[model samples]
Target: MDSSIPSISPWRLSVAPMMDWTDRHCRYFHRLLTQHTLLYTEMVTTGALRHGSVERHLRFNAEEHPVALQLGGSDAADLAFAAKLGEQWGYNEINLNCGCPSDRVQRGAFGACLMNEPPLVADGVKAMVDVVSVPVTVKHRIGIDQIESYDFVRDFVGTVKDAGCSVFIVHARNAWLQGLSPKENREIPPLRYELAYQLKKDFPSLTIAINGGITRNDQIAEHLNEVDGVMIGREAYYNPWLLTTWDAQFFNSAESSITREAVEEAMVTYMERAFKEDGCPWYAIARHMLGLYHGQRGGRLWRQVWSNHKLKPMQPREVMAVARVALAKGAEVPA
Candidate 1:
């Protein structure tokens, strides 16, 4: 092991960063569930950092440590500066986004499109690596469009690795760059986990983490056997309780004793404090936690009370009380 490397792999288990999700509040909520699992910010474009408010984009709760900042851009200079900002703002790692196939990203000449230009991606990675001491990683698909040749992705990893990126978070699926909406791209692409495994085998010195269609803990365990880590995507957001078991199962820590109710209470306290300090509304925070009781009895009713627009004017504690009452009774919202 390198002297710089930690005793435990920081990439061991993580939540994949998703746009429109995985914001500061979401990361904070996840922190309450598992202390050790790595969290990532949604893809922050270099242009945004160059022209936008830095605080609004980089601000995060201190508890979200071991959290990574994922940047979406191809310009080496912009990436280097954005990565420096991320490190200065306390992000634990800097990740390059190479697997997103959205049209917007394409227009910006990055994301999954970057896969077509390995040298360019390498430049960006090396630029960031030179500026930040934190580990630089890349999250990308196995292939792009109809090109399924293993060599396409193989060469990509080889080139980027040379540029000082040692960790690769493989999405385990081809990114259909055309004709597929982002949602469709996520599901329609066939997952070939073997490609990710092969990347680990071919580059044994590198840390390879697998992602895509990995929802169950057993699946995470199975992948971990083949790779260095496992990253859960939308599943972690929709079924957050799944995170409650990660520490005990993956990190060999004690089992979590917190229950669904307790987590909700904690969120209520956080919501009040957030509003008091930042004027952020409870509903804004509440939206991220609506899935806290997912698959539990009366969960829909609980979500209903919390998501109800009429409750916007009420205090978060009051809303939590109403939600708990509705959850226990399993009845419709009061008129």
Candidate 2:
């Protein structure tokens, strides 16, 4: 471990920085599920901040506490400046996105491609650390393309660690930079949990969190023994109920998990308030929660009622009433 590395930050459970999905409203809804699980914003590129309005890219609710701002860029100066803006906007941590395999991100000269250039990443991390008081972190893939050696990721971590970044979120899969879409890269590459576990063994001083393909609570429990934390992506968004149980199960939290009905009602209230406050549409918030009823009997019909375009003219409370009536008629609950 490099002497310059900062102290490890506790990240027992977190959500991945999904591009279009994890926005401010999505995060506020997720916070209702489990208060303990850390949440991240979608990756904000340096160009968006350097040239555009910083507040538009960084605005977040205070309730989304322990939230992190993930930056996408290859330039050290731009990243550091963006990180400073994030801190000023009240983010808890600053994370660099080096694991994203998207073509747009690739063209920007950041994301997974940076894995092939460690020195540049080190300089960027150091610059961000120098400008902010918050902990600077990195989220990256296990390897890139045909590079299968474990040394590839190990060496990347070692180099970045020298720049005062001690916390790493490793998506345990190789990022196929070319000939693979971002969605394919997430699924095609086989997960090697051992590689992340070995990272902890080799760099005991740094905090390591394993991401990719981890969906269940049992899997989260299993990985906790090997690394400092676990990060969930699609599953947490698709089946958000999975997160309701996370706090009590993983954090030894006494906070009882809220019922699905309660969550729906809370969201309905939120939708009404958001409409009055910001004129936000009801469906925008409801769309993120379609999976709330997940495995129940009439969950599909319930979701359909909420998503119906004809109902868009109705208020969220009216939509909620219709959805409840549909669920009641269908007996959505399992016997």
Best by TM-score: 1
**Tens digit of lDDT per residue, candidate 1, span 47-157?**
999999999999999989989999999999999999999999999999999999999999999999899999999999999999999999999999999999999999999
Angstrom error at residue 248, model 1:
0.3
Residue 146 lDDT, candidate 1, scale 0-100: 98
Clashing pairs in 2: none
lDDT for each candidate structure: 0.94, 0.92
TM-scores, all candidates, are 0.96, 0.95
What ranges in model 2 sit over 4 Å off?
Answer: 1-9, 255-257, 332-335
For candidate 1, the clash count comes to 0
Candidate 2 vs. true structure, TM-score? 0.95
Which residue pairs clash in candidate 1? none
Best by lDDT: 1
